[model samples]
Target chain A: MKRFAFFPGCLIPARYPAMEFAIRQVLPRLGIEIVDLEGSSCCPDPIYFKSKDKLSWLAVAARNLSLAEDLGLDVVTNCSGCTATLSEAIHLLEDDILKKKVNDRLGRIGREYKGTTRVRHIATVVRDEVGYERVRESVVRPLEGLKVAIHYGCHLLKPSKIMQVDNPDNPQVMERLVEALGATAIRHRNWYLCCGKACQTEDIPMNMMHDLLTTVKAAETDILGMICPTCFSQFDYGQMKISKKFDEVFDIPPVYYFQLLAFAQGIPYEKLGFDSQRFKPECLLRF
Target chain B: MPEDADRDEPVRVNFRFRRELAQKIEGNLASFCYQCGACVGDCPATTYSSGFNPREIMLKVLYGLEDELLGSESVLWQCTNCYNCHERCPQEVKPVEVIISLKNMLAARGIYPEVVSKIIGTFETTGRTVRITSAIDRQRAKFGLPPLPPVPMDEVRILLEPDTGTDEEE
Candidate 1:
């Protein structure tokens, strides 16, 4: 099995444990190993620049990355928030001047960032390491009839410098990955739209909720496939509020494209972590 | 934003307007504002609502007024995350994402409109961007979903594969 450090970030385990369960059971069959980074905390949620605590943000990011680096392996993450923050830190710390400043602060915690490690999003690993041909070969059940909407959450694509996995304007890697599992990737109005995933705040979210739903409803697809936990939450649970606010019903359920890969692997839906998604058990039937 | 009484010298934020913001819109128009009347002359937001001006925001962001740049309330946020400015820009700037980055930066700072934080907190806690109730119950409601799945406890080690960080004895 291909083994690497796994950072589930705060949400997947806390809010969406089923995704972790599915990942653990499924990735191994694909020749992947996800070692956990013990004692990891929040990605501290990348908005810390406004908070103006670069020291604290770096400390938190270093602490998390240290868990993986100390483990002697680079880190992999499923959440775009975690991936972006972690990778951005890696980029920052890679510079000698910034590294010295961040290291001076991190030294207080007895951690050192050697900068030899990289933080990778799961999609990049799958696309780069596992290869699409391998994914196609591993599929035991193809979702031939399932129509999927792919959400490339901003963090993964934006500033495209750090997370340069696919084309931001026109991305087909995730959709292609979905197609590998026998599912159809649908092009929607909001395919490139932001669900306001990381921009979370009460007044901001409540006010922005309308736009969030407007984009989701505009997609008009059955399964909204996401690769990041932040996007997953916004796209998945935000739907609940959107449905209520707009007074419409959507059977759309959120699924990590990989989870569907597991489902296609003949892994029981129960084992693949489908139960915990926001809408319901039957919601996936539309797929 | 300053308090009522303790007025201090003008504090400058040492930052640059994210190039992605201005280039994505018309005002920064390649960061070469160059007195282009096209922006001031062609803005619909300014024309329709006397208060809205993408040109001003773009100029400020391009000039590197990072704080004053991001400090606007609904101007950038109210910008609709639209690429209209980019399309109209004579110089071709995609300020939409830059505006988004600024908004996200605000949300990150907790300076955003109130609801943005609440929903974000839910995301920080539950791995969701916006959630009303815990999702574990939703899973329980599923008849054919995973059975006896471990509902993750916040304190439980979610990143629990063996850490290579520990010093192993030779």
Candidate 2:
């Protein structure tokens, strides 16, 4: 089994423990071992903390990277935001000057960044490391008739040069993954839009979420498949608020792609944490 | 010539300040922005709120209207940090990075969204953005998950300290 240090970030551990359960249940069966990233802090939230203090942001992200560096393994995160922040920090710290500055802060804590560790989102790990054919072969049960709309959350794809996860404009990797599990991945309008988690404080996030959900509803997909925990929260929990606000019932369930994978891998549905979801994925039970 | 003319024309641009802000950005990507509106067309925030245009933020940065951009309640937070602007920019303007730099400047003065302040405060204390309530712990245990590992909060505090020689605290 290929061992990796798991970086679960803040949300999955604190807010969405079910998602973590899904990841833990699924990855090991696929021959991947997850080692807990002990002593890790928040990705410090790239957008919020980076805007507040870039140096502090770098320090925190570097600190998290060092955990995996100490393990002599690359870090893999389930949250796309964590992957983005950590990857961006690695890119920034590549410069000797920036590395020295961040390292100087880290030195206070008796930690040093050797600049050796790399970060990967779980999607990239499954895509590149576990070949598609292997995923197809591993499937115990296929989601033959289910139609899934993949939400490739923003940070997973963009700032294209830095992320390098997939083609930014025409991304089919997630859709392709959906297909590998024997589901029809539908291409929907505004599927490329951000889940609007960052814009939640203001009215715009709701407006944006409403737009994306409307398009998904119009497409008539059974569920929205995504990788990031933040997107999962916004689409899964936020759906109720959006439905109430807009006075339209959007019963579409938002599910992590991994949860679906575990289900398709024939992991018991009860262990996958389907009971905790706000909008229970009853539609998926049919398969 | 006329009284209306004096009132109608806005004050002259602060060329020096504009150049200073532009220089502060690494690689001078801000100066590279030629305003083709590629970022505007692709920006999700712009599609929702007409007031949240990124190209306009770039234009404001170019014009040295720091107060206008930073003082505005909506624009900066509206950006989901999607990076479509950076990806599609023909000149590699990287409008998102410029906006982040501006936010950094504002945050140095202790100016930013209240939500950001609240979240960062929690992170500084607990080494996690959200506290691990008893209920959450119960849920983790119920799922056959191990207890959360401890965080080195003391080390986190030291790392979060304002680096010496920077008056960010003041």
Give the per-residue lDDT digits (tens) of candidate 1, residues A199-276. 323344444545545565577766778787766776667777767766777557777766777778777665655665
> What's the number of clashes in each of the models?
37, 0
| Tens digits of per-residue lDDT for model 2, B88-108 | 999988888888777776776
Tell me how candidate 1 scores on lDDT: 0.60
- Which residue pairs clash in candidate 2? none
- Per-residue lDDT of candidate 1, residues B1-170 (tens digit): 22222456664433444443432212233355443645544333344345556666666665566556566464554443223454445654545434555564554355665554565455345433334243555553342333222222242222211223431110
For model 1, the stretches where C-alpha displacement exceeds 4 angstroms are A48-52, A200-220, A281-287, B1-55, B61-170
How would the docking of model 1 be graded? incorrect
Query: In model 2, which regions exceed 4 Å deviation?
Result: B1-28, B72-74, B166-170
| Candidate number of the best lDDT | 2
lDDT of 2 at B123: 76
